[model samples]
Target: MTWRPAGVMGVAPSLVVALADHLQKLGAVERVRDPADRRRQILTLTEHGRELLGVCAELARSADAEFAADLTEAESAVLTALLDRLTGR
Candidate 1:
């Protein structure tokens, strides 16, 4: 997730930290200390975050379907492949 925002989305690491702090405040995620490494923290999604993720997934699927409505099945497949490649998925 950090790699996605920093590398794929081209967001600054500082901004990502700020956003992470904000999410923590909002109870979307919780930070847990790593057992093996006291210096590191692990961020895990909360119940709220899981629900939000499900909603986002549905919305993205809807958007993708709408965006490809006019294209043929083959064209949509090509577009999806291109998008997956571009997103480094």
Candidate 2:
């Protein structure tokens, strides 16, 4: 994430670190030393984070459906494609 944040997530590495630290403090994520390389740490989402993401996914789907209600099916497909491209997915 620190290396690919700009392209993959559209955020700065420093910003990701800050946000990850906060989430860790909030029990949404945990950081542990890498078994193979003690100098590095791996970040993994906790149960809380998974639950939060599930809720977020639901809300995002609802909002996207509402936002696309007026567009034709082709237009909706194009919009989704464009968004996926922009997000480097």
Candidate 3:
């Protein structure tokens, strides 16, 4: 659905489903049917998924640091502030 973050990321529903299945195979997530709607499946992160999230966070932080390395401290702060405003953060 367009309401999903995956949609914002430009991922097709079929790709999302495939990825969810792969995550299930890796014990990183599980899919459960919605009790109210049998056709709808919800993907919930497992403990492994939480660990993966931690790693993803670290990588994102490192990338951010690297990307901002050329900017002065004040410039970095201003850029961050502007980006936050644009992103409605």
**Among these predicted structures, which one has the highest lDDT?**
3
Native-referenced Cα lDDT, model 3 = 0.87
lDDT at 11, model 3: 79
Count of steric clashes across candidates, in order:
0, 0, 0
Ranking by TM-score: 3, 2, 1
Question: Could you give the candidate ranking by lDDT, starting with the highest?
Answer: 3, 2, 1
Q: How far is candidate 3 from the true structure (C-alpha RMSD, Å)?
A: 2.9
Q: Please give the TM-score that candidate 3 achieves against the real structure.
A: 0.75
Which 10 residues in a row give candidate 2 its minimum summed lDDT? Answer: 1-10
Q: What TM-score quantifies how close candidate 1 is to the native fold? A: 0.74
Off by over 4 Å in 1: 1-10, 35-38
Q: Across residues 12-67, which tens digit of lDDT does each residue of candidate 1 receive?
A: 86787798899899788998988977866678999998988888999999998898
Q: Give per-residue CA lDDT, model 3, range 1-89, as digits (tens).
A: 32574666677878877888898998899889989789888889999999998999999999999999999999999999999998872
Q: Itemize residue pairs with steric clashes in candidate 1.
A: none
- Compose the digit string of candidate 2's lDDT tens values, residues 56-82: 999999998999999999999999899
Instruction: Kindly indicate the candidate among 2 and 3 with the higher TM-score.
Output: 3
- Candidate 2 residue pairs in clash (backbone atoms < 3 Å): none
lDDT of each: 0.83, 0.86, 0.87
Best by TM-score: 3
CA deviation > 4 Å runs, candidate 3: 1-10
Would you give me the overall lDDT of model 2? 0.86
For each candidate, what TM-score against the reference?
Answer: 0.74, 0.75, 0.75
